[model samples]
Target chain A: MQSENLISPGFADPVFQSQAAFRALLTALSEPGLIQQVAPGFAAPEGLEPATAIALLTLADYETPIWLPAALRDGPAGAWLRFHCGAALVEEPAQASFAVIDGAAEAPLLADFNPGTDQFPDRSTTVLVQCAGLAGGDIVTLSGPGIAGSRDIAPIGLRPGFWAEFSANAELYPLGVDLILSQGEAVLGLPRSTQIVEVR
Target chain B: MTIHQSIPGEDTKPAYNYAYLDEQTKRMIRRALLKAVAVPGYQVPFGSREMPLARGWGTGGIQITAAIIGPDDKLKVIDQGADDTTNAVSIRRFFERTADATTTEMTEDATIIQTRHRIPEAPLTSGQIMVYQVPQPEPLRKLEPRELETRKMHAWAEYGLMQVKLYENIARFGEVTTTYDYPVSVNGRYVMAPSPIPKFDNPKMHMSPSLQLFGAGREKRIYAVPPHTSVRSLDFEDHPFRIQSWAEPCGLCGAKDSYLDEVVTDDQGGRMFVCSDSHYCETRREQGHRGTMLADASASGLVEAKS
Candidate 1:
């Protein structure tokens, strides 16, 4: 693909678009398992979903190094991220502040990415996974800070044993990586405080 | 910093950036806020920037408000629950001049309320965010005085020092003497300092429907208590946590449930009690709630209460 084609139009209005996107992200994160629409509102590369593209646009800067899967690394999404967000794409997941991956195709061990040290868990990498859809999969009940009693979510196309791994991840509270699952234009936040229970 | 265009629909760059903070700085704060929300009570450190005002004031609250604020937001700034205070007025005007956001004195009308030392008397509803100006974000800072030790304590959920302090207060004063800046256990894990709000206001933090965000700019730390989260003030089984009670209702508005402030009326130490929350008191008075001190309207020449 030509370099120009990879560099598609980003946010039309950077300030307002980013603020809107950030609010969406904030609501999703604060209320785990709650779905919020995050629209880039512009043309992006083929590989990047609107939710993922807008998240990266609103958050990732030159300072926040990004880790992408091998296919996306050399593809249009990588170039687009670099061009629009000025993100430094890292080869290793541990080196990145953000790791963008397609969970349907690749399911790397969650531990493979940085969970950060016990002292500073906020330093952990925030994993943004592109899922198949916000719904239509195995249902899991979520309980924790944001939730009142409990909330159920069923994000499709997660790898096998993802809930078991997520259960273990919550046990490492204030240390595990936070997940922002995106599908097309909708996003769901599953932070470290979230407990995924009874996945069937 | 490079000069970047900020205004919407206009190519001509303004004198200041949007909300008076650069995009990069706002992004940094935004990222930190997400982590803070995720952790619930764990203090997430961020790259604190120098504001137009100094750090000791409401800079932390201002920074959080700026990062989250947009043109459409209705902001309400409060200093010790009064909207007309100097700190509140200056910060309100700052947002108006920079972000071009509409400012309101009424708590119910605000989408985002930035406060120092008190939560509003009115109950916070969902879809509203309460940003607190925390002078000291770390609850254990006073006891431990070392960041490294405190971090380890939070990591291990070791809050014995906090308990010991409360125990010490009980031994000394027959109860938990620490009133304002009360320590609370968040989510049964990290112990958090709920700013310098009166002990009377601490109960309001529990299961608040509105999202609560706390920022300490001088300390470069941010923490949160998401809606419906449990925030229990530390206390023993026998000697439970209690809020302050007032014998007399508000002298101006006759509000019995709200936090009260004592005002000296004369040189001979004559005193009267009034609601600390100016807006709340005004709203109550407008509803025709009269106190013992309030002059009777329609029958008296003075509609306003005399000092």
Candidate 2:
């Protein structure tokens, strides 16, 4: 057997692990900028964090096509996700229901992904960006639904124009892509309803 | 313990998937839930599954609970704010068997509380999630029967018809007669139906610290209100939104702040009001809170000595 063929195992108990992971993700999204950790009982493949792997396994399926950046697409992470989640790998971000971007690398413009339509905003893509860490970066203020008055988040290793692209995406209110930042085992959510103030 | 309908629980644990739902179905609902949370008050259409229960009886809430619940979670189910009601107990029992999960009647102890037609009297914290069984997810559907037009209304934030509906109610009944399922604008964007929960519970959702999820199985839609989001009930400037209040306190727990239901005690047209939230009422009674009816019962020798 090839070295890559022996991919790391997914959740031990698919029922509990996925349910628990989904709850954690829900908590993160429901309270924007709140970091939540879920142990999906699986090791991460190359170039992907454990949180990313847990998210893909819990959410992605054949129906939800996923678009990965070049590094993840070419690496073992792609095969791992394809094997574990059975999610269709798409080259174009527009065709993807979910997309994963490496924050350390050059990320594509937020416009590249689907912003859904004015009628059905739920069709918008959910972008998951793998970051360096959940903290120790430029602090940004978030306000909107899900947040109380305001929330401050500082996730490391997002590209320079990332916030600008996110701001442009926010301009499209109920039609923007939701972002999730995963670092190590911590995941912070920034849904489209959340407004990004500045990286101060 | 009585079975109202055929809620045949599959005793064979190994045969069925966890929580009586397959992983694929869970993931599908999970995706819809994420979208629902992302866009507050927007009814996101999803693939509604056929559950063991009937479609009209909280299948959407059950599916949402099944999708989100884990073994470690303490599930709580309520119908009309009563924990011991047929619908509430059955659903709670179903989850207990299928998920092998512990169930709690107390609001504070539960991680996820599934409800039909009422929000708990107790304040919900940020850690807890409230799943509402919504028969109708679209607030504009009743006024405008056309689906496309309603979608356009939501898309354009055109809620003139809703105001007209309330206005018509005022013109006919001297007040907005919509006692339950009152419409509210979530985050100032989309108007959402907060299930059939009495307008008394409507104020509980505004800027609430707890996450709220609404599911309609027949409508095949899911919507959400994230914690601390603005949920403003629709009403005219003169006709402000007001909750139902009673002059008398509860007969069971002496609760004046809780929503009350009138119960007729005699055929002579005599009635007494009691707290609708069974768990809250029971806890209060246990704490030696006496009420008008409790004193009467004690005087009549109907009260238990222990209580």
Question: A1-200 in candidate 2: lDDT tens per residue?
Answer: 98876788877777777777898899899899999988834688988888988999899999999999877887888888889888889999999999988886774777899999999999999989998888989999989888889999998898888888888888899899999999888899999998987679
Q: Residue B120 in model 2: shift from native, Å?
A: 0.9
Clashing pairs in 1: none
True contacts kept of each: 0.68, 0.88
**For residues A73-152, could you state the per-residue lDDT of candidate 1 as single tens digits?**
89889988999889999998888899887877645667778888888888888999888988989888998888888999
- TM-score of model number 2, chain B: 0.93
Model 2: per-residue lDDT, tens digit, B72-183?
Answer: 8899999999999999999999987777779999999999999999999989998899999999898888788899999999999999899999999999998999999999
Local distance difference test scores for all models: 0.88, 0.89
- Candidate 2: residue B21 lDDT (0-100): 81
In DockQ terms, which candidate is top?
Answer: 2
Which 10-residue span in candidate 1 chain A carries the lowest summed lDDT?
A38-47
Per-residue lDDT of candidate 1, residues B1-307 (tens digit): 3233445677664667778888899999999999899888889998888998999798888999999998778999999989999999999988887888899998999999999999999999987999999999989988888998999999898988889989998999999988799998888888999999988888898888889999999999999998888999999998999999999999999999999999999999899999999999999998999888886765675466555
Task: State how far residue A161 of model 1 sits from its true place (Å).
Answer: 1.1
TM-score of chain B of each: 0.93, 0.93
Per-residue error (Å), model 2, residue A6: 3.2
TM-score of chain B of 1: 0.93
